[model samples]
Target: MAGRSCRNSIPVAFLVAVLFVLNPPTGVKSDSSDHRYKTNEDVPLYANKVGPFHNPSETYRYFDLPFCSPAHVKEKKEALGEVLNGDRLVVAPYNLEFLSNKDSEIVCQKKLSKEEVAQFRNAVAKDYYFQMYYDDLPLWGFLGKVDKEGKADPSEYKYYLFKHLHFEIAYNKDRVIEINARTDSNALVDITEDKEVDVDFMYSVKWKETDIPFEKRMDKFQSSSLPHHLEIHWFSIINSCVTVLLLTGFLATILMRVLKNDFVKYAHDEEAADDQEESGWKYIHGDVFRYPKYKSLLAASLGSGSQLFTLTIFIFILALVGVFYPYNRGALFTALVVVYALTSGIAGYTAASFYCQLEGTNWVRNLLLTGGLFCGPLLLTFCFLNTVAIAYSATAALPFGTIVVIFLIWALVTSPLLVLGGIAGKNSKAEFQAPCRTTKYPREIPPLPWYRGTLPQMAMAGFLPFSAIYIELYYIFASVWGHRIYTIYSILFIVFIILIIVTAFITVALTYFQLAAEDHEWWWRSFLCGGSTGLFIYGYCLYYYYARSDMSGFMQTSFFFGYMACVCYGFFLMLGTVGFRAALFFVRHIYRSIKCE
Candidate 1:
């Protein structure tokens, strides 16, 4: 026994050593900051170029920043031009002016005339900000600082930062605009006895001209990032993989050896052959698929879970293959929304099928619930967040038209898809197949020990899955809140696969233990066991907010938690579905393999 223990220890020790080597504490850290301007490539500015532009009918109108001129402050129309003959239109560039430094204080040499100054003041009064693009990056330049009360500060000076812009000509006539810029107005100044202070300013603009196709331009922007030494995710990946391997090994061992022994003993029970007395899980095979209580709710949850699962897999695959590459701002959010909308049919189908199997008659209600269960909370949260943004006059707020369009998409596209899928599912299957006949009386569950109880098992099961993704979670939070770009979709995709495997394996193990303990109720328990990971994830979000992020402001806080709630909800559905499906398969395989009367 001692020697066998030592032999087992060797593999465990080897795994630990490999993980340590792969993910050293001081391994290279990758930054997704823009590095396009760092190169020596000459970017050209064309003054003769003119392009057609138009806003999507469903999208909010984007107003450009007002540029002050001698005649008046020019407010560029959001509708620049339209695509002609399936070709993208390129716009002419703005004239450039240089600033000079005198006595360590930088000043604009070409000062605006009195008329131009008046126009500039008018532009400021109208709250117009300059909008430009550099290589598919959008740069929004603010001329003044606004207070928390949404008022522009009178005493603060405005600083301008400029960088190169890149434009992509798309085949579909969708224009690609990119701008790179950053501003810093905070610098220490010395005040003398007379209370006079000296201040300095810095500003520059770089332009790069490229005729790259719209697709390639996006690819370039997404691929562009600061120099980094190595990917540190290898450590997290290895850690998660090791965990999954161990859990899978345990599950496989039990299924093959322990369950096989039980089957053999049951098969050879000659004394009870006439009476056909069964033991263990075989005793409950008849009731295992007897349709869980709260059938509609459970079906809805499963359907939504299936939808989210499919959406997640497809999104990751697209991202991994560079479909969302070039890191356009808001691209990820847009993709998720669109994909979820398109996948509503999957949710409806699963829910209807399950509900029908459970002998439910209210198909319409089930379909509605399936669509609303997850989306309802999300929409409400978004509305509240958008309201707060509008109150603060922040750019984050979606326009009323955009909001209406989103509702229309949900109502018109997603809702119909759900109905269609539900109809198909209900018509196809009404009765679920069970391995054995369910007894009229439900089996009485035995009281479990503390460790095997629902709460304890869920709490323990959740932590392992959470541990696998906590490291990646940090990077995701940084990208969202810390104004950093996350371009490593390949790593993200791998970690996501690991997370699903971990959730499934742990759920199966916990479900088996519960069944072994004579707990016939595994439906909700299996879902909760896997879904509890979301709770742990939310806890980590709290830690990230207070300890990792420098975020402040009530609006920011509201947005963070509101969006996080939606995220956690989706995670619960996805992971819970994974757990339930795995457990269902395990139960079916085990019961079907045994001899039963």
Candidate 2:
């Protein structure tokens, strides 16, 4: 045992070092800390990606449109996380001096050809918005506006491009605190013509001094729409708390009153019990401990669930501790991907141990299944989505080098750790222990009523848990799918706990009822019962897609459903494991107290 412990510590220590090196204190802000500047230091402005307002994920390079570029056309080298978030920051033509104001100055004169005009017209029709960064402060402006008023026919609709920009830069001491870009409707040019057009792009800069510190500058960008978000978040938290309390009440009632009575009744000798009644879960002691069929899959699912649950808690803790913030683009994704890969050992160890307990001998196959169970489907989905993004020429498509690096990380680091954990699990295995001995032959399950059937029980088991978190789900969906930023990790963590508790309680109740119905097949049923919450969540996703969101088009639709499917599938695994373990403990306790033979 000491040798095994020592061996495990080595890899764990290495993992910690690797994590520290990979994720430093560096935040989503630009690497440049040259905030303190003289009166006339040249501050370069970089333009980012542009995308349709409705489809946030489907973005293209800013220069993809017929926009004027700098004479040098220099691109800023972005971090891996930034690139993953589809940020393409390139130096723009507009040059500004610190604390210096400029009047309406012509940025560049451009003669747009027929193709360029068509591209601009298309961009305007889609309501594309552009983003730019000056001194690490982001600014946004629309490419054009659609005038729907005074137009009877759809074909007669007018598109007007905003040719001029007004920039406001706020400074405190020597630091740039805030920056904003605004377009005037008066300076709009009619882009309804498809022929060549000569346009002069113009911009004005106004500098203002303030007492606001540089550290607090990002707070303004946090949430402009906070009151509504706070109200909904509080409501959801209260709703989840009430649901958890009710579930706990049910558990307490069952454990204290009902189970206590059953324990006393069953404690009597067999003859005395037979004289009164021999019904309920106590009758199925012999078959309840029987190894479930397809136990390999169950083990793998449990292992994956364990990994996901830990990953979630760890990330939330990191978020709470300020490792990442809402403004940090791709930081969360980068952490999730890295942590999941590093924690492959946990999944392997868990799967191997459970499989061993079930008397499984195909260790190699079990290891492979444990490794690929979740990653296989996720990889396939990502690949398909990436292909679609590439075809659409969207910035969401990962570069070939990035893809190769990710693959290498998984292949080199994740795989070896999985094998090591599997080896340790196999070596430290113990025989399965059950309070009640299983009979050689399985017991026949009696006919159950409609309400007591597995499907109905599963439906009942899932609904309560889903109801607990459905409100929170809306906010989560909005933040991910829409433009809302999710900064409420504390609330999310609480709701997550409530969800696990609700799932465990509901699943255990169902398992108890199933056993009482003389159905000893509680293993897979308990898992599926808890996991059914994911089904309810997926159903809600359908409702949210149609009712709640304005998200349209093939790319956005596919991205939403595909990624949401993966998330819901993860919920299924994590909650299913919680249910299975809870039910197993409940069954063991009750059987042990009753003196199962």
Candidate 3:
């Protein structure tokens, strides 16, 4: 045992030593961009794989997609994201570097199928926008070898973003135009070698009909780089790790303190939680579950939205970590639907297994309904929309067939596990055996009544943070599905992680505040806590469309429609996530109270 442990330590120590010696990952000295988001400095593999191709269609694997934020002067981007409705919003940051292929053939070899080619051409002809599906565009999207995170081996072939455009002199500048193309003084460099430039250079074209010959032909040589936000870097990882560890530690401490407190357990006693048990819900005998009966449906919906908000964060985080990766294009929304669909077992099993010590329940229908209602609609909806995109030749079709394949996998893979979990959750007697126990007799849960219940309180909790972010959301959906050259993917990625943490904290704090104000029945309102943030996003999108953007053409109008589609979908997603989470809280509240063991 000692020898084996020593052997393991040797490898660990060796690895750490190597990392330290590297100091930086690559040999390239830090440039302006590398200072913020570091890039590996070694030359990537130069050759493209050729001949005897088995799975040619594998070139479009969703998992293999690469994206980066467009390069800007940095200052300009911060201003864009910080303005307008930002109270409840969490924004994504941008990335701003690009690399080139050693041999252009690597990208060229990534051939598209007949159908895809047809789709692209037809979509363009029909005035339909073919959004870049997954990572690459139909033709130009496959710029080079990919260089996403966790796959940085120097020798292996990887897709790279073309940082520089080689200006091919169609009419020879030296002979035809009577100027030197390569020289700094006279003409634009017509070279075969690709050089780095910012993506902004495309829009920031500084040419004129009448400029001096010295400057006109080859004046400014600012690096023309493109954006790729698919990868996360060392600094981001380090920053996130440090912050997440500290936050997690602090929250864990608070949870422990709350759990250990005698008053808290007593406050959660039985009758106080379960005065109105419906028999159908009895498998969860000690468990309590109730919606906040607000004065109106809108108010109740707000509380439900809070639930959706928190859950959305969870789903997005999972997607961000490459859990689903390129395998599914609609990973965020897809994950949401699936998680909500199977919550009944989790909720019921949690309540029944814990409150009555019954993890195995006879009420499979209840669990199915809980999870099914949420999951079924989303799958069907996406399937429908995906079909439309295909018909219209929209590149945004997002590997719809692939999505169906993955969904089927999830159903086959996850359904049984959920069912099994529910069975065990219902049958378990662990709660009774556990040394920890809840206090007996129901304490009067300070009567807010349904109208005065926790729903209103929950809706308010997440509203402000959501407001802070709505502006940011509008730009994102616009850029992704919209044809605008999205250049700030790195910033967007960082902002995404930050938003999740910020939103969750804001929601939790608000929910706690409402409860402390003697609103004991906060079941549905909890979801409202995080969910109400989306409304702020919707408002900002409208504002941007009206004020900031120049939507004069058909493309602009179409983009507007696409943006609206995303927002509406996003709204329902938020609403569903909030509802699901509140349902969990309600179940937890009741389970803790109803326990007699």
- lDDT top scorer: 2
Arrange candidates, best TM-score first: 2, 1, 3
Q: Per-residue lDDT of 327-374 in model 2, one digit per residue for the tens?
A: 565666677778888888888898998899999999889999998999
Tell me the tens digit of each residue's lDDT in model 1 across 226-316: 3441246666678777876786787778766877687778778744547766667777766676678888999999999999998887667
lDDT for each residue of candidate 3 in 1-597, tens digit (9 for 90 to 100): 999989866733543333223222221112332222223222111111111111111112121122222243122111111111010111112111222112211111223344433333322222221011101101112232223357566334232233222211111211111111111122111111233322211101111123234222221211111222223233444555465556656755674475445245444543465664432222322222222343223222332233344444444444344333221223333444444433323443443343233222334554454344434555565566555545543333445344565567457744664566546756665743322232343334444455344456444544544543443465465444333333333444555555555455545544444444444344445555555555556565677666755444333344454445555545644543444444445335534543434
List clash counts for every candidate, in order.
21, 0, 77
Question: What TM-score does candidate 2 get on C-alpha atoms?
Answer: 0.94
Q: Which pairs clash in the backbone of model 2?
A: none
**TM, every model:** 0.71, 0.94, 0.40
Better of 2 and 3 by lDDT: 2
Error of 3 at 532 (Å): 2.3
Candidate 2's C-alpha runs over 4 A off are 1-31, 224-228, 269-277
What's the lDDT of the predicted structure labeled candidate 3?
Answer: 0.36
